[model samples]
Target: MSIPAALRRRTPRGTPATGRGLRLPVSACVVAAVLLAVVLVPLLVPLDEQAVDMTNKLHAPSLAHPFGTDDVGRDVLLRCVYGLRVSLLVGVVAALTATVIGTAVGAAAGAVGGRTDRMVMRAVDVFSSVPHLLLGIFIVAMFRPGVWPVVISVGLTHWLSTARIVRAELLSLRSRDFVDAAVSGGASRWRVGVRHLLPGVLPQAGLAAVLMVPHAIWHESALSFLGLGLPTHRASLGNMIQDARGTLLAGDWWPTLFPGLFLIVPTLAIASLAGVWRERINPRRRSELML
Candidate 1:
């Protein structure tokens, strides 16, 4: 049977079919692998930094130590894996917290749509005016360095963008036929907003949450690097990188290199997945890509 050319999807010039087809799966696998490692690695492998052997400090990468040894003889590979666990934990928790807060605030403001909306949006703008890292630094500085503090700081600082996205989505959805029909059918603003609007925003909220993960991870890493995040006793990508400062300058690169790769790879994979998701959700973009 002959198919219509209009319905046929065409690849962009110079793009490899195999690469395009595999992009999503590869990104999914990378994300899943990182998540699995974060969850299961601790149970399967022991990472005891205190059990360090000074004799092996700053060793280069070898079969016995894939990522080499850190300044204290702790296994770089092990620490990187453990650090990944901490980063992922903070990122996921903070992103979820931000999502919840943002969704609630945005939904309320968008549904009410009056002085209430103006006030809420003004507040969002005020918060957005401050650099997130600076605000995060200020917030974390007030408390002792720990995972929870970083999570709170990151979550509080990151919610503004999500709130804006959610609010815009709600406002757009407000004008839709279903929403108008519900309103015409004697639905109160509260009922219409909650029953009709909230559910409609969940998918966008979810994608926002997913995309926030990498940003949260970087924020936590920045805090840790500045000695304001998780304690030194814990493994963290930022702490690891910070600790490797001297070693990196002294000609040993693996200490800094490996942890960085761990950080960069997972974030990139997540971002790729998020991009795919965004395209899927946007009808115009989806159609453009198809044509």
Candidate 2:
């Protein structure tokens, strides 16, 4: 229902505490935690994330190979298990880059006002007017193939919407009371902006970061699907899906199905996380936001 009551902070007298207003979505909690676990364990446990075993090809799901094997005999479970690392890594890096660039540009536009805001927003509008995939393709075409290329290209292309969002939020905050108080207290523009305004900006940025993960995941996969992404040796989700695309009609269901399913999990995770954020922000209105 409304931001689960179980998370409500209570005192011995059964009154709500200072933390009472904050809430977390249970589904997001499980999904985010599971994703983190999947990414970390393989790295720490010494299971070679990229070690290929030719003899194990095409084995169906069993005690040993849970998800099954691919056409080349690599353990599908191991690949999926490790593939989360690659996908999440790309998603995290690209999204952070986008957020940082967006935040800086947006902050300056909101803080300076007048010609600066107009110029920055006009630039954002120009970029946003173009198709994201088209820009991504051009970026990929410009660079030689690699993982960083995907990160940089996606990062650059995806920042406009976030920049606009940050700009709008900062605009709203610019005239607020504490902002005025900080200014009246003789705080420098940078200090007041960073200390007072930026703290308020974080919730949106956090939500943006989580929401951006799915976008990054889908973008990377689409790029690889279009043949403009990570090279074979890297073993990204995109490359996995690209490998599976050829086998889809050949009755090689494992290759296609497994990668697709893995991609869906994170998309679902982010959607759920976004929902939780909505609920936590507006407990009574969570259902409206959910749909």
Number of the predicted model whose TM-score against the real structure is largest: 1
Clashing pairs in 2: 57-73
lDDT of each: 0.89, 0.76
List candidate 1 stretches off by more than 4 Å: 1-18, 188-191, 286-291
| Cα lDDT for residue 131, candidate 2 | 95
Per-residue lDDT tens digits for candidate 1, residues 128-231, read 99888999899998998899999999998888888899999999999999998998899997898779988879889999999999999988888898889999
With a 3 Å backbone cut-off (N, CA, C), the pairs that clash in candidate 1 are: none
- Model 1 poorest ten-residue lDDT run: 6-15
